[model samples]
Target: MRILIFGAGAVGRVLAAMLSPHNELDIAARDPKLSLIEREGIFVHGAADRKIWPGTKPQGIYDIVIIATKAFDIIRASESVNEFIDENSTIVSPQNGLSHVDILTDYFGHKVILAPTTIGATSTGPNSARLVSLGMTFIGSSSGDMDREKTVAKLFDHAELPNNISNNIIGEVWTKAIVNACINPIAALAGVPNGTLLERNSLLTIAEKACYEAAEAAIVNHIELTHIDVFEWVKEVMRSTSENRCSMLQDLESGRRTEIDEINGVLIKKGESNGISMDVNRALWTMIRTAEGRRLP
Candidate 1:
């Protein structure tokens, strides 16, 4: 099956290479990055494997369309690349935080599949990725179609991006959202890696509070996730990528737009809708946004 992977950033590059051996994989991205991939091939270095993509973009109707971009870019990227997708296509989002499914479903229709990949990757340079870690990715459909979810699961296993088929994907999404809510902003704000918070309970409490509030907000939307699950998941994520910098921190360091607005900011908005005060998350959101603003101007 022909597959088109949008983004070509760290996550996208790792995904493209991981699936390269089993299918016809194409990396569709910005010009310079695309040009680099076309010229030098994408070099993937890390835990499970390493390789180089020496050529070509996939053509025609893609059987699987994987989007690995940040949450903020999902809509515009989908709209811009609509021509590459046909009715038979199954779009998978391997992005972090919640709301990817709703946004994709709104634009790409109900055929969209939600995914959260734990395949940790980092870009050492433009159009280059290192597959630093391994973890299970979840796949499911928001429209409650088992067939679509199954198709995505089959491909994920085929490509060796370890996956679990989830009936409670909304909950899975929010679980990951809660984790990102705690880790991403704080990591960026303090300019530290995930493990840096391990002993910092004073600051860690701030993160924990945000997780509790976000979990509560998620429950209001019928996304059932317990605070314990949130804490355990975040702890696991930290241990997994203990040394790596978060994507949000990477964005801040690079002076690029961060997904804080989508991750924690999404939770803040959800809290508002439910008449819940996500004051701590809002405060972190404000801190990250201020950092983001500094880079912009």
Candidate 2:
């Protein structure tokens, strides 16, 4: 199978390394990383280890196309993938929030698979990524095609990518979003790693409130959560990846646009519509927006 992973940063680097050895893999990447891969190949370490060379351009129509860009880039990224998609292409989205779910589904219909990975991967440098924890991936289609869902699951299994075929993928996706919504924004605002929240009661309390707010919103909206208690799951993630900076923190520190809108912004919309108030999420959302503005031009 030919697979193309668009956006070769962090999670994308780790995925390209994992999937390349088993399939004809191609990756879409920018400047130095693209040239670096062409010259030195990609090295993946930590939880999953591998070193493989990946092409910078697609050879032909890919059986699977993974849109690995940050949530902010989804709308534009989805449009660029059209050339690589044919009648049978499967578009996999491993994004963190539920925001990009409908956009990709509405764009590609059944071929779009909502895949959310909890893998704690970060780009170490120009040509490498370290997987802090090998989090499981949940795979299912927003269009609800079980057959295609299983097929993609089988493909990942063959590629040595850890995953589960979810009957309730939206729920699974929401579960990840909830954990991220609770943790990422607070981490970004506080300028701390995830583990720091564990030691600080104030931050942990804020995260828990955000988690509870989002969880209640999920229940109110009738979205089933795979995790019975989301805050516990978030704490476990924080412990396991203690030293790693959350993506939101990384984005904020680098002066890049954070996915607060993609993560918290979407949650606020859902929670407000459900009349959950979502005060915690809204506060973090506003702070992130203000920070983003300060970084602009």
Candidate 3:
């Protein structure tokens, strides 16, 4: 398969490394990292060690276009790669949150696939990353096309990456988003790793409040999450990636904008639309935005 991945960040690099050996891979990224990838190739360390594909700018239409950009950059990433999409091209977005699906569907129509992965990875440098934890990835269609879902599942299987096809990907996406909404901002604000949220009672309390709020919002929105115990799921993730700094924490520490709006802020908006109170989410959203403002010039 010919694949083009946008945003050579942690997850992008990880996916590129995973799929490069089995498929034709191209990475659409900005320089000087682009030049570095072209020169040094993508290297994975820690849990796995290998040199993946050398990055290149995509030209012709590709079999698959993976949007790994941050939620805020999805529009730009999709537009930038629009020329590379054709009728047969399958666009997969593994981005965190719900809004990217709407954006991708709007642009790519029924060709869009929603892939939400729990694999933990962190970028060590421009063209290098470390795998923190390997977890199941769920691939499915928002439109419920089982054949297309199975096709994408086969691609992951061929690459030896763990994945499953789901009839309800939107539910899975919401479940992951709820977990992210609980842990990410709390970790960022506390300046701690994921496990720390579970370790500290005060922090865990905050996360629990956010989790239930998000759960209520999901219920109101008619999203049937697989996890009956959301808090337990969050705890499992914290334990699994104990030492790993979440994406939100990494963004804040590096002085980059965090996806507070897409994660927590989105929950808050949904809560409002559903006539539910998301005070905890609202508070976390405000706090993170304030911290981000202070980090700015």
Best by TM-score: 3
lDDT of 2 by residue, 188-291 (tens): 88998889999999999999999999998898889999888888998998897787788888888778888888888888889899788899998898898888
**Clashes in candidate 2: how many?**
0
TM-score of 1: 0.94
Candidate 2 regions with alpha-carbon error over 4 angstroms: 294-297
Candidate 3 matches the true fold with a TM-score of 0.96
> Which 10 successive residues of model 3 have the least lDDT summed?
288-297
Span of 10 residues, lowest total lDDT, candidate 1: 49-58
Ranked by lDDT from best down, the candidates are 3, 2, 1
User: Which pairs of residues collide in candidate 3?
Assistant: none
Segments of candidate 1 deviating more than 4 angstroms? 54-58, 226-228, 294-297
**Pairs of colliding residues, candidate 1:** none
- Top-lDDT structure, candidate number: 3
For model 2, the run of ten residues with the poorest summed lDDT: 288-297
